[model samples]
Target: MEQTLQTSKMVTEKASPLSRRVTWYIFGVMFSINLLNYLDRYIFSSIANTVAKELHFGLDGIGFIASAFLIVYTVFTLPLGFLADNLSKKRMIAFCTILWSISTVFSALANNFLSLFCTRMLLGIGEAGYYPAGTALLSQHFPSSQWGKVLSWWNVGTTVGLMTGFILGGMIVSTFPHGWRLAFLFSSIPGLLLGFLVWKFPTKDTETQKVSLNRQLLKQASIETIKRIHQLLHIRSFVMLTAMQVFAFFFLGVTVTFMPTYLQQKDAFHLDAGTAGLYAGLMVVVAGVAGTVLGGILADSWQKRFAGAHILICGAGFLLGALFFAIAMLSSSFLLFSIFLFLTLFCVNLYNGPAAAATQQIVSPAMRSSALALSLVLAHFFGDAFAPSIIGIVTKYIDPTHGQHFILNSAGQDLRLSLLAFCPIALFIAGSLGIWGTRFAAVDQENVALPAN
Candidate 1:
């Protein structure tokens, strides 16, 4: 009888080789899609100088364009999250990919600042659905035990995409006439094809989990959505985690939007767009990859011995990242600046996987997408949406006044000072919140029903 039970357990525990291969294939496709998502979003930053000059945009105008995307992205995510929870996530992802890709193509045709701004807003609508749907889909496939590791690898797509965007945009703008437009046009192609691939691919979990709908059921689902949101907010750990993300993402917004320009204008560097892009991309990818992977592994391993190991790891990363970033901003030597910047990125990224997985662990399966969407809305709206503009405003105001107008300086000092003032403050807040969150992590996880493998 004991042998029979042991044999049954072994058979149930082991996944078939073919099943494992298919699982990895799904991960690969999703990773590629995520890469494209960020690449399209960040390419503008890579060629900000050219775009600003050609479009006759001042510093404030440039920041406004970036904020427009985040504003729209944040607003649309809630409804998309609702759809993801109730409908087929795979189909939603496919549709969003196609929509964003088309918008990206249209950006190439934009003739003026207004046209380009409109295109970016449309692009935000298309891309807002991807994260909530993608993360929910991942939750369906992997068990709680492996969530950190799986998500860490998935998050790597972000760094890779950012790197590609910076490098590709820089290369095109530097090498070709009307290169910024061409860059946008070229970036749209892969996403178009990838959208079809996502639609064609068989996602077994999505198929199996389809919910039947009627008027009564629709009403119930809507009610449940509201109740779940209230419940999620009530969870102390979840709220704390969200708070931590808010501050962390604020720094992220400032860095990604302005770092390339900063590096170019710095007295010690004075690098062109191409060189700045190459170096920034390389630094982000190398440090980001290492931090993401190591953070996940350490979080997972440490969780065995500590109740809130993931939160602890995240807190340390934020604190250390801020310290390094401060040093980088203060340094006069280019090499010293580069080294510290790499460390800053590495530490900042350490929370990506663990924080995401923690949210999933605390929420019920039905509310997973909504929770993530809400998190995104809060993080972007309060954190990143205004950061670029704030920095830009600070830069403009600090510049010497010429006649009646405050002239914008290209010396990089104003921008650097703005970043130094904001980034460290935000990072410190995030780290403190992360540490506070550790106290409630175990209790929150216990309240939720663990999803089956």
Candidate 2:
């Protein structure tokens, strides 16, 4: 036993420096890609009004376009995630980046609704492989103790990308003759370059043995994949966590898709698209940065004293976010609404890091990608996949007689009412699930053979 201990200590000491360097390197590259990923994804929403007017699409049509991207994205996540588990994640990421970038460029060339929808579908296919592969790679590099901080920092890429997308997209549309198309064209360039960079980076493959693409191996892999998914479903904590993600993402999807348009069209605000976009972008960046950093730090600190601390933090964030957002919707004063909006964004974002870290902690390393894949499938499909369309449908129902000549102010009222009815309910349910899931986190973590911190 003494000899074994001595050998283990020696091995750990030798691995530490190399591991730390590799961890940071991977984080840097993945972080950049994540940022680009969201920037490309959200460009359409930032310029939603311009696109809708140019293409002659109704509110429902606009929502459908967003939904199409998410639907394809959700559908492809599972199969692509399976590929990440069995293949070279670095190569997969590179290929995905290139494909998506090309699709973005194609979006710029699209002249009508069908063409644009097809390009968005292609964009979804390209982006589908990124999150599972990236998150799985990050989980492999860091131990559980550091997961919250690392994942939180990684998620900063998302908020930053969102801010850039909104501000940049707005600027392009306001400044250029064909700004929306130009925005897509310009965004594609960086993604193409990033793909090359990711390809050149010396990322280590997590899979121990490279399986050949033979019929026999493919058959076995499929069988194993099914069994693995089945096993994931049995984990009570994971199920609850996924359930929470569904509701949380639903709220997010609806807000991100329409909030700028809401500000621009509403009677109370009635700001132009560019100004609305800039304000909304600033709100997300300022509030998101502060909240994400605080959430990770607070969860990590609380974890030292209690089990399932991350879950508790997430629960609080959801409940508080719900309350603030509801107040923001109701308030007539612009200043009060902005204050509440900032608070709402901050509270909603608090879950970004902790939830991701908790997912990694509760699962074994081999199953991490699959676990995330399943969560994404459920959260996105049941949550955000239809949220925008549902909101649009609700708006149409509330003002059915508007027809082809819908008044902007009336449209805004319909949207606000729909959002007010749904967002709070989903958030409340998410919070309740988080609280309930805390009871299972300790046992779930114990079941996994986690690496030593």
Candidate 3:
């Protein structure tokens, strides 16, 4: 079995058509675009506190607003994924980028909660198209052996964009009047240009197999779609990996929504928004980048010795990450919190690359986008989509009067308590799921059916 597997890998490598330079160029463009995706998506989260003050909404309101975007984001992903599978991926990506950038620009025009919520929901619609298309497009470019590394490299865009949103939002909001508006305005430009690049991406290579829209293809039945989804769910490893995604997304949603505010509160760091953002953003870049890159390398390298290495790495990261996350949230001292936060971000981010690679590996080339889209639908909807609101409710109602005398508001302390409650427990559950999934990975891989390359 081992010899046959080795031979198959060797053949796939030789069959790959992407030259190193072309491959890297595609990666660079996709990575940059992906960075922009998260940058615009999280800018709202980065400046949630300011928005709440200006709009006269409480933290709970902020939670609902964040959830609004995610609900829209989750709802549209599968439809967009179907389009991604049937249409030219670059074109879909290009259009999605432009759509989201325009939505970000509109975000700058909002003065009230309703307007902001509407703009964010639109942003969700625009941003939803990129992942399914980009992931599938890139997966088709590399052999299976390279998916973990390349996807990890691409996934770093999330950490970079998220960090940039916080840092940029921080620097601008502190230095100037109406900085949040400017932040949104500034973020929209790069995507417009990147969308152009995606649209014009060289199609000379046959390997860049552009799935074009045809009459019959357009009329493809819903039953076929259902069948595709059914196949993916039946794969035990895939099911577990997706089940784990929900918890991880929930942890991220809560953190992104409230961490800056948490750090800025008097009882905590007592820093200005800029300083708080700087600290949060720095942690994201430093620790997040480290986790993602190293995780990818470890998964790829370890796979040589272990068939379940990708899932194993994900499980270990999530478990270790949860421990650090709990410590970071519990620490009273700045030094201790910072140290544990770095550790938490590193371990929490470790699953990005390996998880992406694993999902792709188990599905066929044709269903890759839709399968991942299905996972996103469930993960984001149940995970981050309601996290802010759930946390918000907890903060507002659950022992709402506990810390009234402290420098923090009732909600602020509630936010801390909420994070303490949700983040670590979710991470632990996610880790446990990943460990359980590892056992099925090898069996699933051996059984996966793929069309001839």
Error of 3 at 200 (Å): 0.4
lDDT of 2 at 446: 60
TM-score of 1: 0.92
RMSD in angstroms between candidate 3 and the native structure over all alpha carbons: 2.7
Q: Estimate each model's TM-score.
A: 0.92, 0.93, 0.93
lDDT of 3 by residue, 220-253 (tens): 7356678778888898988998899999899988
Query: Which ranges of candidate 1 are over 4 A from the true structure?
Result: 1-18, 206-222, 266-268, 402-409, 450-453
In candidate 2, position 308 carries an lDDT of 77
Give the per-residue lDDT of model 1 (tens digit) for 196-306: 988876664442246766887679767876886788799888889888988998999989988887777734367788888898889989999999999999998877666
**Each model's lDDT:** 0.83, 0.83, 0.83
Candidate 2 TM-score to native: 0.93
lDDT of 2 by residue, 339-436 (tens): 99999999888888988887877777767787888899999999999999998888778776753424444477777898999999999999899989
